[model samples]
Target: MHLFIRATDAGAPPYLYAGPMTYRGHEGERPMRILWDLAHPLPADVFHYAKVNTG
Candidate 1:
């Protein structure tokens, strides 16, 4: 897994994480259980980012 992560990470080094982790909470008094979402970090949208003049 480490190798795979490294390869993917190299492919796109700007993103913090490439996946999302989710889990369901226990029953609550409101008759609805809460779902938890955990993620490492948000990635930058290069499509909408300003272009730099490297020239």
Candidate 2:
């Protein structure tokens, strides 16, 4: 999938977010989890995650 992110201070979405991420978060260090779920659904027991980190 093609991902595009922009720098902003207003803090709202409809855009990919960026931050100092923690490993404790449910989706790990990935920023594409939500979109991935919508674009591609998988079984609850199945693990198929993807990541695309950029500034």
Candidate 3:
């Protein structure tokens, strides 16, 4: 799955988010989580999400 992130005044680049994330199979499908705070990285159990260029 892919997520669209907006450009911020912060020095970080604008990009799409992805992750080798592992979520609880709630119902049947896994969910995606976006990590906006780059300074403080989130774990894989939560979602090691990152940004990538789409356009």
Off by over 4 Å in 2: 9-34, 37-55
Residue 28 of candidate 1: its Cα lDDT?
67
Q: Cα deviation of 48 in candidate 2 (Å)?
A: 22
lDDT of 3 by residue, 12-50 (tens): 667535333433333433665433324334445334232
52 Cα displacement, candidate 1 (Å): 35
Scanning candidate 2 in windows of ten residues, the lowest lDDT window is: 46-55
Each prediction's number of clashing residue pairs: 0, 0, 0
Instruction: Kindly state the number of residue pairs that clash in model 3.
Output: 0
- Per-candidate TM equals 0.23, 0.17, 0.22
Pitting candidate 2 against candidate 3, the one with the higher lDDT is 3
Error of 3 at 17 (Å): 5.2
RMSD of 3: 10.4
RMSD of each: 12.0, 12.9, 10.4
